[model samples]
Target: MAAASIMPPHTNPPPPATARDPTATVSDPQRHRDAPTPSLRALFLRAVDPSRPSSWSTAVADLLSSGDPVAALAAFAAALRANPAALRPALPPALRAAAAATSLSAGRQLHLLALRSGLFPSDAYSASALLHMYYHCSRPLDARRAFDEIPAPNPVIVTAMASGCVRNNLVYTALSIFRSMVASDSAGVVDEAAALVALSASARVPDRGITGGIHALVSKIGLDGHTGLANTMLDAYAKGGGHDLGAARKLFDMMERDVVSWNTMIALYAQNGLSTEALGLYSKMLIVGGGVRCNAVTLSAVLLACAHAGAIQAGKRIHNQVVRMGLEDNVYVGTSVVDMYSKCGKVEMAWKAFQKIKGKNILSWSAMIAGYGMHGYGQEALHVFTDMRKSGLKPNYITFISVLAACSHAGLLNEGRYWYNTMKTEFGIEPGVEHYGCMVDLLGHAGCLDEAYDLIKEMKAKPDAALWGALLSACRIYKNVELAKISAERLFELDATNSGYYVLLSNIYAEAGRWKDVERTRVLVKTRGIEKPPGYSSVELKGKIHLFYVGDKSHPQYKEIYAYLEKLLERIQEAGYVPNTGSVLHDLDVEERESMLRIHSEKLAVAFALMNSVQGSVIHVIKNLRVCTDCHAAIKIITKLTGREIIVRDIKRFHHFKDGLCSCGDYW
Candidate 1:
């Protein structure tokens, strides 16, 4: 298309040539030879076109500054027709307009004009602008070709080229270009922008060796002392290149930090599962980052940490801050608050937060549905899912997993089967491994063992350890030793290192009185050095976390906690709570197994929470493993005796115990 058709000429006369940033033009080497400071009309009137008036270049700049890029292109064509020399000062703005509009067609025409006018090789500003234009338009190949056409690139041109490659996810290529920038002669010396690009590349590929090299170069060039480059490297570390939390913490401790710096470190700690440390860093930001008030990003990251750690008190405080800052409507922070409350075992609070989100994105809807599902409210989750679809947001694969899981817990087998069968046909989502696992769990929970096994056999994707492990757990509950053995074989083959599977199979064998099989499995586990993660329960009370292991006495208040637990057991037994010693799978006599059942980790955590917190307050306990059947029953009775609501989150799902019953209907 012609330039006039692309951007028709405007009837209004354009303003002066010096309308945009003075630097937004191709640098002219000889233009300074004119007047020391030219008048407004002659500002860009270089001697290259003494015959042409400066107004030709003036029109292009005016249209560009006024945000009329289409009109700018038309004026650019007129300027070129008047004098080709005008391109030296007028080309950069036209390229800027192209980049801003993300128009590759207009940019390509300008690229041709720049090449034909002999400005590409000499003008650094024009070359950089062209590179940025191609980058913004998402044409990486054109950017690389434009970059290659330059003979001797300056630092600006090299930085621009590296940045474009990094933006396009050609990280290794960006690294190569950065290396050349460092190795080339004086004109291509590494600058702050080039260093940041190289650091970003190192992070994407997650090559610690490359990051180390760049880190050394940054230090040698004294860029490490600057906040901009330092924060970039911190971000690289956070993304898991060498993931050296120690080095990252050290760098974080020494650097002159900004809000971005604090946010990166917090995200790094949280991502590495050091959520406690992440929360600590956020606290430090409040105290040490004197001028750096918390922003939506900071609150979002810290709220996620709170969710993972069950730091509800800290989460509530952050929510209050979000309200104070009038960021209650921020999609990110609002969604984070919902997730925090949901995972921390406060679904009612999550619903409140979910309702307050003004622009509820897909993530917000998914979080709310998952929250309802975890609380054993299958009907509520389905209703919210329907509302999500009505709100014009299509459910993704993750949403289906939550739906099926809710069905599994609430015994909605028909609904679960309908969603599983139609996920591909209705939502166009082929069931992935996670979806398959959720379906297996759902079918197995409903005692449809034959059908669950058949589904596993018919799966298009390979069955993972989680899928087989689900079947093994179901077999233990349903007393199907035959299928359990087959599931065990597949589970061990896929993930031999998972100690949980070995324990699950052993428990199945033991519960069946197949002592020989149990002994054999235990011997195999011992020989392979497989150790199950010790079960521990944690309760977040008043911003401080309390941990309890089986018969734990490590706390300073162990005396009071143990004493309280004994009184609770007596009271619960008087109220018809029987200690279900059947869960103790070890080869012990009935008395020893009964004694062992009295002090399970979750019971101790509940006792501690009961003693420390105010009367009638709800207690939340987070477990690192599945809650045993004995503790599940006892907690339901404890909720009744203490007149409190106890929420327990195990590895598989959340169990809400209130009024002498569990939300799972004693099924899970």
Candidate 2:
């Protein structure tokens, strides 16, 4: 292709050159004779005379204020063609900065102009600036070509190229270039050292080998512990995952920590699930020293700490501070609020906070969807997901995870399958193990156990413990002992140390009346030293969660709780209720078994919630396990007898019992 065709010509000419004389001047014979040779800058200064007839040199300077950089570059190119001497000073920098600020089309036009004029390789400064423009415009290959053609790349040029890679998330390429530069003969120089040092410091790339190499080089140059480099080093170590808090703390102790250092340490602790240490460090920062003012990042970090601790009181206080600080609408701060409320089991508050976000990005949608899914509001979760799509926010992997989970809980089997297919068909997202697990759970919980098992067999990647466990839970609900055994075997084969699968298998055998098989399973469980998971129930009262386990009688009002249960039983029996004695796993006499079924944790929590609340109040109960068969029966009776709606979120599904029936059709 002809080089001229690359840069389209300008349709409009520039203003008269004399108008730009203030910014640049032209060299005359007398001036060149006096100076012998004029510098590129002096040539522009000498050219700036309004009395001098307009030349191409002054026209190039006028392009800076053109508002449209593409047109400016074209006019400047036309001017350069008219007077080759105009590129002496202002033209190169002006063209470069303008290209950097404009679109790729404009940047390419500048490159075309340089190529057509044969000035691209002749001037190193202009060439470097052109390279920087290409880097800014996200043409990394073009940047590499520009750097390679520069003959001798300077530190600034090399750093710009490496940084472009970092910005584009090609940290692998950044490390490669840094490695090549450090192995060079003059690695100890400030220019080369700064490039590698900054790369190591930024934490964009998390390879200890590469960072350690850079650290050694820094020490070779006697440049260790410089605050900027140290901060970068600390971030690299913290984010790299191999480095421990001990090393990070040591680095922090040795260096003079500004806000960046403190923030790095606090964030590192939070990222690693070390919330206690992170809060401790934050307290130390406040009480031990007083100079540091917490910025938005610092406050968000502490807010995350509150979320993890489930410290609603502290989180609310921090939220108040966040509002007072006027960051309630900030996306990061808002995300923290959504996460805190969701983890605190107040998803409505999370949603309320999410709706107030002035700018909703992917994180905002993901947080809200996840919150709704956590609260078992599957319909609300699906609604928010649809709203996200209507608002033009493409669902990412995490968003899909939340949506799939909602479908699983709500038994939207066909919708779940459609979205699962859409991940790869429309969005080009290959299903990960977690996504596959969600699909299995969705289908398994929907009474499509055969299809769910087939899905596990059909997965591109091997199914993991989570997928098998989901199938096992479904088997337990549907009383499918055969598939339960298959799922149990698969789970044990993959992860033998897990005791939960053993319990699930044993429960399935018990539910099926296979006593011989149950005893065999018990022997296997004994051999593995597996313990069954304890049952727990949570009731929200006066903004506090009151949890009770099986056989729990430690409550201050246990006597009243039991008494309420007795009266409630009397009323339910009067309303034609019968005890579901079959829930007792052991083979015992019906009367003896019926007596034991009344003391389940969920029943205790239900009785307590009824005693504590007034009539007509909706009782919300969250259980750690699937609602027992006997408890499920009793809850249906209690709902009709007491005229109350009870929402029970069990491990496998949601049970909405109203007027002697469950919303799940007693299928789960």
The Cα error of candidate 1 at residue 14, in Å, is 9.7
Per-residue alpha-carbon lDDT of model 1 for 52-166, expressed as tens digits? 5355555566655655565566556555555555567778887877786678888887787677667886789889999999998899988888788888877888888888888
* Least accurate 10 contiguous residues by lDDT in model 1: 33-42
lDDT of 2 by residue, 1-668 (tens): 11132244333343354343354333333333223122233333434442333444444444334333433344455445444445544356545545545467656766766777676766766776677677667777887887777767776666666676776666777766666666676754355445544545346654555555565667777777576777777767666546646767887887777787777888888777566677777778877545976678877787787666454655677788788889888998898899887765567788888987878889889888877875567789889999999999899988998888777766778888998999889999878888888888888877899999998898898889989999999998889989998898889889876666665677788878897887787677667765446677767665355677775677788878888887888788787777754442433222223444337788888998888877887787768777877789889999987788887767655577899998777655
Candidate 2 stretches greater than 4 Å from native: 1-12, 15-109, 126-145, 164-188, 191-226, 288-290, 389-397, 412-434, 456-465, 481-668
Q: lDDT for every model?
A: 0.79, 0.69
Task: Using lDDT, give the best candidate's number.
Answer: 1
State every prediction's TM-score relative to the real structure: 0.81, 0.64
TM-score of 2: 0.64
lDDT of 2: 0.69
- For candidate 2, the per-residue lDDT at 502 reads 68
